[model samples]
Target: RITESQNGWCWQGPVEVVWSNPPAQAGSPRVPAVGLHSTTALLQVTVEDFEVVCKGLYRALRIREKYMQQSLQRFPRTPSQYLRAIEGEVWRASDTGPGTFKHLEGFPLCLAEDLGYHVQMKDGVVYIYGDKAAADRNEPKDLPYPSLERFMDDMNFLLALIAQGPVKTYAHRRLKFLSSKFQVHEMLNEMEEIKELKNNPHRDFYNCRKVDTHIHAAACMNQKHLLRFIKKSYCLDADRVVYDAKGKQLTLKQLFQQLNLHPYDLTVDSLDVHAGRQTFQRFDKFNDKYNPVGASELRDLYLKTENAIGGEYFATIIKEVGSDLEDAKYQHAEPRLSIYGRSAEEWPKLASWFSEHRVYSSNMKWMIQVPRIYDVFRSKNFLPHFGKMLENIFVPVFEATVNPRAHKELSVFLRHITGFDSVDDESKHSGHMFSTKSPKPEQWTSEKNPSYTYYVYYMYANILVLNNLRRSGTLLATQTLLGRKRSPVLQYLYFLAQIPIAMSPLSNNSLFLEYAKNPLPDFHQKGLMVSLSTDDPMQFHYTKVQCELMPSCCPSLGLGLRGPRFSGKPADAGPPLGQPLEQRGLCRQKPLAANTACGCRSR
Candidate 1:
């Protein structure tokens, strides 16, 4: 006889047992058999060492659960239930979806009446006071605010846990075991799974719901699309004023003349917006690709939101991309728009551009990406301190939430925004290490950039309080893609928590890592929750159907049924209301059933 329990990577770990008894007497109560177990059969470590690792892992899960619960974010019920069971507590059914908000189902597009609350930022987190009186009294509303001290304490503990010798050894072995076990299961059950998939009817890859989780708004369309749009704009608006250079107006034709280029002569090669071998490991070059024909004026005119044309070109490009997705009938995309925290007016201007241009799309959900370029802002004297930058980024959202009627356009725009992303090159090293003694954001006036962790922490901290105030589900920065270099302990934690990752091997191939070196296949086989994404179609893809480009990478990477599965469960930046956030363990079956119900017909 054997007992099995769920392991960290969503697979079963078998516990062996040997019975030392004969048959029981007929019609009599059977005596329990003496149970014997092998010491080396289960854990390869000493019992004390195993217990120590187990305790550390349990505490880590608890830490995440606490943070997520307080922030109104989703924490999978399985781990929560397990934690409760370990503590000998009853698991209530109503507790399964703690982050669920009933109001999201039919959330209004129109502005709501203002609540007239006072919103303020202190220590990088927003606080909502009931009134000026409450602000004077230093009392915030009942919403929970995360303590920086406690967060740093938990962070230090987890950091220490990942570096511990025993924990590292245990996690590494466990991950290897999970990978090997998945390989064995695939060898034994791959045919049966395929057979089951094929037996299901009326569904194929074409009809399956696929989502492009990671894409930028400026480059959402392919080079061909951009080229055609440019030509069409020139043909129609050659005389229309489109740009203002230092208070002088320029039309489409004049702007082209100023840049020494013409739309009629522009080919894809001459467009020169695509990433190539030269851009590899050079993020600067990759970034420069945003400028068409090596001209920043073209980027500013077509790709910027606050240009003389009021971002008409950018909006039209996004609308066309959305229309393509709608035509595909089963595809969706979450495209990120940039929000440089140089001025508070940026939010209102972007919102007005969105509303004015009518950038509405059923197939598209929006996300705001804050670029980690504080040093650039500081060097230009655009910002006095990092704290002011944080204020510019988050304070507007807080005001919109607190007084929707006052900031009508921004309030409406915020409704479509599902999440926030901290975007930057990860390879760059910051000299500063974040800690309790580190300078506060207001005091961070130095020209050097802060560490990556510093940006992530403040972003999460602010988002945490914001979510608690709004009561919505947002996929936070925790679900990042590039975790291959992460410690074994962190990787194991990600597995346990079922964190979703959006991998862009094509984008990674051109800019950072080589395609052959991608860990996507290995992550998928090891049961890490991974999905495919075309990070920037304009730079990396040639196809008009940009979402389809990712699936082509699947076969070369040896992904069969896994490819469709990844497409089905896109890590949505913010799922519109009525789509419950995916949960793990017993709760995962609903979406798994839906994804597989379509069948792996292509595979």
Candidate 2:
């Protein structure tokens, strides 16, 4: 009942099973102790259990601290007597020995201060020093995690954190710059001030991805939450806020009202909007209603969108938000477009729209952020359209594509973009034998050999395009090289020509321990300028530590010493013949990886 499959996996009982064979030379297969139950899964499960325990412990400590503070009455004869009574009560209540249920040990005041929170029990009510909800990752900004009542209190805590050291004016950037420059003790004064001002900098965007170079308000903000109005006392007298460099307080609801435009997807409800601190009587009616914010204005902000109206809507918001916030003055931000749809066919029109209405301002000018460009590989002819659009559509200087999949087609494409092949005319079409595939090694006559010809033309044309774009600080390259399986020639050219690379785990690759992650540091060491960007933040299983990724995902996001890899035949005393690694059915360590991406030699 066993069958061999082309992809090296076996199927049985509606499931696919993979067999592993190690130490091929020893005539035996190695079975790891854990088998496919990798260490990564083990660590993830362990971390989750630990976090659950930590969260429960923190909650217990909070309850105990509150109860102890409430026990204090009309000033016990002396402060010492009051403290002693509270300590004795806690010791009796805490049943740490057998976990019948008891208070967890509380952190000292100094510890809380160091962590940027305060725990004080002054009045009958306990006031926490920080946003308690922020500690909970499951809390969504647009939707209350617990109930409406709890979220109101959490919102106040978040706002209070911001109010402590507000950025009232743009006069202090110079000091901030100096602090980040030296980052030493002498600049501690500026460093301290910068820290206070930049806390929750992503608050205005209503999102948490600070690594983003381009942002979209429509993608992050909830129109429903922005328009909701509750009694002033219910929200602690807070209202929806949108920051304007000119000091105009505009809310999502107000922005539409002022512009006199309505998008179709949102439903406006002003009833629950926060009113005065005056507690309402029982006669109040719920005014909150879902408004249609998803009108034509936001429909086509994504890439491959065919609707011109949608594109214009996206463009208008970018301009409107930029103008309102004066992002150029503060942070020099731009718009982002994630285009993976079959939209390369619509490039001419999209480019036309972007060209005529490119965003330009005195302090900042962002061409347009198109981060995902994977669909262009649908045809050999598709990529040149994108290359031409680089100039025609006024694309942002920086863009990224999926790695070099379909090396055969990409070979044709590389030639097309480099101008050796022209747009399909009566004389040239995609099927032309000249660029159908790389010329054979036997056919190689410097200009005819796919190896030499591809290397030469790609370097010549791409270098010109790259150099021009570099002057303006714009770049175009691949996002993930993990599964591309490109030939060694392509790998060498990418490095020699200095193409940018963004590393991301592809389909079926573990974010923590994929073999692809190994190439990242090697790429960097080989002088390939690379960037790490999240492919789909929502899909990844996030932990508190990984959420602030600098600590864990850096250098290598994946797990363990890559299982031992041996390439090619061992060296001998006689002189060796130079042949393709694939030709000899061997692996050789050159340009990092020993195996061809396709796991076969160039035919």
Candidate number of the best lDDT: 1
The global C-alpha lDDT for each of the candidates, from Candidate 1 onward, is 0.66, 0.26
Q: Candidate 1 residues 509-592, lDDT tens each?
A: 677666556676567666666655665642233232234433333222232223323222233333342222121100110100
Whole-model lDDT, candidate 2? 0.26
lDDT score, candidate 1, position 6? 42
Residues 361-440, model 2: lDDT tens digits = 32222212222221233244443332332222222111111111212222111111101111101111132122324432
Q: How many clashing residue pairs appear in each of the predictions shown?
A: 0, 33
Clash pairs detected, candidate 1 = none
Stretches of candidate 2 off by over 4 Å are 1-310, 320-348, 355-358, 361-548, 552-603
